[model samples]
Target: MNDFLIPQHVNSFHRANPVAKLLCMILLFMLTLFTHRLDFVFYQMACFLLLLLLFSGHRFWKISLIILPFLLVFIASSSTMILFGKGDTVWWKWGLIQISQESFYRGIHIGFKSVTFAMEGLLFVLTTPSVALFYALMQKAKLPPKYAYSFMASIRLLPMVWEELLIRRNALRIRGVRSLRGGMKWLGILKLYMVPLLAQGIRRAHRVAVAMETKAFDGQGERSYYYPSEYSKSDIWVILLLSAAVAAALLMSILLPPFGITDVRYR
Candidate 1:
């Protein structure tokens, strides 16, 4: 299942060192936060969207499904400010609900910012793998192997845990155990499902801990990695691409006609 979910065609972004990619993402995030102009934010979003479409290596429908939630995010984030935010020029007012020119601009700016953040995050996730990320953290970022390996183990265990839950459900069905309906359904789930799952998880964790201890995982001795995380030309390309995106966004924002909003903070 996990193998099917990942794209078969590995792009340059996917080949880049995870630590370098992470740092680039953090820098982009900080830049977006400092950006207050609507035009700039919009262009930043456009750049990210273009990058995602070009390099994600996924089907159009799959990419669309991944980004569908951000539509709701844009709406929810913009609506609150548009309806209730303060402004000098009132457009419409009905008791608590108010719409103003300033508020409308501000809301749109905020919506664009939110979507830009989401796109950047999706771009990272679509390119980077969980296993690669932990390995990169340990190798490139100087993170302790014990912590990195523990996180990797936990992530790898998730699929097995999900399978166990499905098996338990099937077993109950075979035993003619009907699911509880109405308000008490949740309580029944806690008693019948949650308790066993929690106990199983605890026992599994203990066993893993014991196994790690036997292998001297907690020790400070140097160890070789099965999957080596190393810097390459791909990392440099990733950095250059991101830098170009940022530069292009700034250039477009400057060349395009302003939305009459210079600084959103002043408004």
Candidate 2:
């Protein structure tokens, strides 16, 4: 349980300050938003994906499995622009559907941007632990203890909630209860599962609140943390590495001739 709650470090990147890594992610997000060149976006997406594969400390197949779902995200994000966007060079046209060269380029660019965003976010989530993140925010970002501890409490409760749900499901199966298969199906599920879950959650929350009150956690006085979030030289290295990635992507975009489409906005 302790091991499940606290993730082991995969590499130096995983050990870097959570606050620093979060800030770097935000900076990368801002950079991605301003970038309009399709080639630039592609390079950025590829760079992040490569970093994810390298530092995720998983086998190639495992990483591929993790990334498989983002294919859907890419398709879903780009489809709209490709199907209906306005442009001069029409490739195909039908009733209420249009495809053009500029739209195709724009759609691909948007897809790349979306995938890059997901990759960057996944990189952070895969590397950082919830406990460490909340603690980092509290200590370094000056987040209030009340809010941080509440977030931590919610994280702790999630596994137990999942376990309870499984137990309830098993119990229902043992009792020969089957779900309804019609218009009333969703309502039946809500009544059977959601009600119990909500009731149990409320009870658990009450108990936790009382326990916290008994321990004087409500006080605003300075308190010592069991898991201290600290900054070290590795944080600087993490920042430098991410900055280098951004620079490399930009350089790649500049050196390689763009795919005949520079800015997606006017083209």
Candidate 3:
């Protein structure tokens, strides 16, 4: 199940102009940050999922599962907070626990807002090539050259990580080595996955260090970029759109403080 939900090795999005993907991330992140309205956030998240469906793989509902556990946690936490929270409108009371209308509102608010936050983040993580994303960030954001190179060193390691995990999984099942009841439990399976993965990871880390040394990766000196990470007209358009979205959220927050627009507030 984890393997299914973890995004596939998709090279499709690579065809999109790197700049376009960057713009999309910026706009979605801006929407996430500036919008205080829960409904707007929810809508934005839905829209992002929709984008994933339309753009790369339309089978998002089948593939996307990471949203579930976090949503469950937030719903539980917020419900507990609201039930015990001190507020003016007490819905019910017991010897040790009380449920208030105010608490209910607050919890629902937090839960819905959290959905927005998580979905906002998925925009960058689920889509967009890491190398291209980092290049755009470092170049346009003016990150220090030495830091960018060091950061990129880690980003470049992901393929190695993925390959190692893939190979390990294949090797285990092939060897016919049953571990703790033929992988009857997820925990048992996780052990099979992790032990070999960790070993490979440690080995890869050492190899990476040696490779970096061979390439003379001394961050103490100046460096040159292989890709021209310069900005274009699309970047300006993206920035302006983001600014407008932020301004709109701020305006709405100030004007409509009473009639909130997000979550399960329909009771």
Candidate 4:
């Protein structure tokens, strides 16, 4: 989870143009939406998971465990659709809940589809630095300076907010407040933390704004970047290969129909 805040050096994804990475992730997700077959969606999920493992600089099991609850929730919710949604062959029936072969297969389709998309999104987040992405938006995507700087400032402020929360909690501990392991005490602790944190946040925002102004970050003027980021041939190759993979998955779906959605419901 901390990896989201601090990106690690692992592969070329770190060096890729942020605009290109963002576009590629969006395009890949669009392709996943077009895939109706569970097998194709699983293929997409596997590809993304592999990429994450290869480039995220984190252990495979660690990442899987972090996302396991989300995957389970998606699977449960989607599979429940099999019990409630329309289908032909009834496999089970109880209190308005029913499961049919068609519905079961459909559930698998939706569940895998959700997993595939989430994996891709996590990959993008783990690999791309938020600052770099926002800067790329300013440079390549032509985002206005005011919006870009505001977003960049917010991103930089997140850690400070978290740190302030921690400091307040520690101060409470020093003042003879025992940390509750659980129960209703956590809510009270949260309430104690909020007011000071809010004031600190406002003060920090003012300081940041003042600092930015002193650095001549006027929203209307052209800004210069210390780091040179631009689209390159590699970005084109990344998109091209992704497109080809989508085309190949489609072809495979057609040729290997059994590996995809079937017309016959389970008997």
Candidate 5:
């Protein structure tokens, strides 16, 4: 199967611009934050998921499962709150907890609301690499270079932390300290995990400082990069395409009724 996420061949879209995607992603985050309408929110989530699926391989589905717990809780609680709470019109009530027509619709709305925001974040992280994103922000967006470097460095450190945790967890398992079920025991387990992780993090930081010093690392203003990024024709198209997509979603949102199109009548 051909990989879609990274793209085997740097197509016109991917090749010409990294900044376009960054801008689009930032726009996506802002869009999700701005809207409370479920339909518009769903449109954004749908677009995000559709894009991820197109670019990402079948493993994309697996990647999405990373947030299954959040989805499950969101759906479950939203449904419970929506169905069993009383408001404007009471469908049914159990003393303090009453199921109302308004509550039910609200619950469904809340579920989709959470899902939309989650997908926006997922899309950004899945598509953008840390270093590339940082480079774009620093050079293209003219952001602080130190901020970019720190962001990139944190991202780079993630894998090492994951590996260290995995190793420590495995060692604990081998020593019959596998299950973290008890009270203080859990804290002990956390300490066991943290000791090596913190030590390594500090060690890595010092090494990075030393390496930078050895290379005469001066965090100065206006640094130049080797692979200079320039906006191309495709970059222009990407920005245009993303703009059109967002506009369409917004247009649809305004055309639709304020509290949603149809009223629900639950029997």
Candidate 6:
């Protein structure tokens, strides 16, 4: 059941220009940051979730499971601030902490804004592949080839790092070594595990550097790309649609001032 909602690797959007997706996500992030009204934030989040259901092809519950904990933590911290801060209509009182209507509203606003930002971020993470993003950056964003290749190489090495760590752990296990389970000291765990992982990472980095030099990867000058990224009509549509959404949100905030136009500050 959960598998059905998982995103297909070979979707049309997956093949769409990564630059467009990146720019659209940036617009959404800007919207998340500037909007201050809780109602508007909630409305935006709801719309994003609905779109995710329709288009993400990823399990809604799985993403929610990853997102909710951070949201809850943010809410808790915001609630703490509201409880401690001064406000006009006090609901509860303690020696240093007091819950009041103004603080409560502000906290709610902050919490919802956080959710809006997280949802936008999740959309990017779920849709964009790392290689595609790096390729787009190099071709479209005019990022230096060497820097882009280095960044992509680092990302590609993550699986190798994990594999090496697992192999080390299994070997240790076979020799009756134990991890920092059941309240063992973390410092000891780090000494046992992290040092080897660091060594392996450094070794891999050295090999990658050597390979890049072998390929004559000078950061500057002309280079040919095997998978040269190009903009398409779909990319234009994506950009226009997202830009329009951002503009519409801004316009709505202006016309309906109460929705989100006002600058909210904790007072």
Which lDDT values do the candidates have, in the order given? 0.87, 0.86, 0.60, 0.74, 0.65, 0.71
Can you give the TM-score per candidate against the true fold? Answer: 0.88, 0.90, 0.59, 0.78, 0.74, 0.79
Q: Give lDDT tens digits, candidate 2, residues 203-241.
A: 998899889878866658588887899999889888888
Q: Can you rank all candidates by TM-score, best first? A: 2, 1, 6, 4, 5, 3
Give the CA lDDT, 0 to 100, for residue 199 in model 1. Answer: 89
lDDT by residue for model 3 (121-205), tens: 5544555556665666555665555455566776667777788788877787789855555445768778888888788777876
As a whole number from 0 to 100, the lDDT of residue 124 in candidate 3 is 49
Q: Which portions of model 2 miss their true places by more than 4 Å?
A: 1-9, 171-177
Q: Write the per-residue lDDT of candidate 6 for residues 1-267, one digit (tens) a residue.
A: 134434754344555688878887887888787776655665666656655554554665766676668668567757865776657889988787888876776777677677767767776666766777888888899888888888878877888888988998898899887665666587887777888999889998999889897887745766778788998876776566555555565555556545442434555
Task: Please write out the lDDT profile of model 1 over residues 37-143, one tens digit for every residue.
Answer: 88899899999999998888777788888888999999999999888888889999999999998888889889999999999988888888888898899888888
Q: Give me the runs in candidate 4 sitting further than 4 Å from their true place.
A: 1-12, 54-70, 171-190, 262-267
| Shift in Å, residue 112, candidate 6 | 1.4
Please state the error at residue 227 of candidate 6 in Å: 1.5
Candidate 6 similarity to native, TM-score? 0.79
Q: For candidate 4, give the lDDT of residue 233.
A: 72
Per candidate, the number of residue pairs that clash is 0, 0, 1, 0, 2, 1
Q: List the residue pairs that clash in candidate 1.
A: none
C-alpha RMSD values across all candidates = 2.5, 2.5, 7.0, 4.2, 4.8, 4.0
Please give the lDDT score at residue 184 for candidate 3. 59
Q: Which prediction has more favorable TM-score, 1 or 4? A: 1
Which of 1 and 3 is the better model by TM-score?
1
What are the runs in model 5 whose C-alpha is more than 4 Å off?
1-5, 8-13, 54-77, 80-86, 173-180, 216-218, 250-267
TM-score of 2: 0.90
Model 2, 254: alpha-carbon shift in Å? 0.9
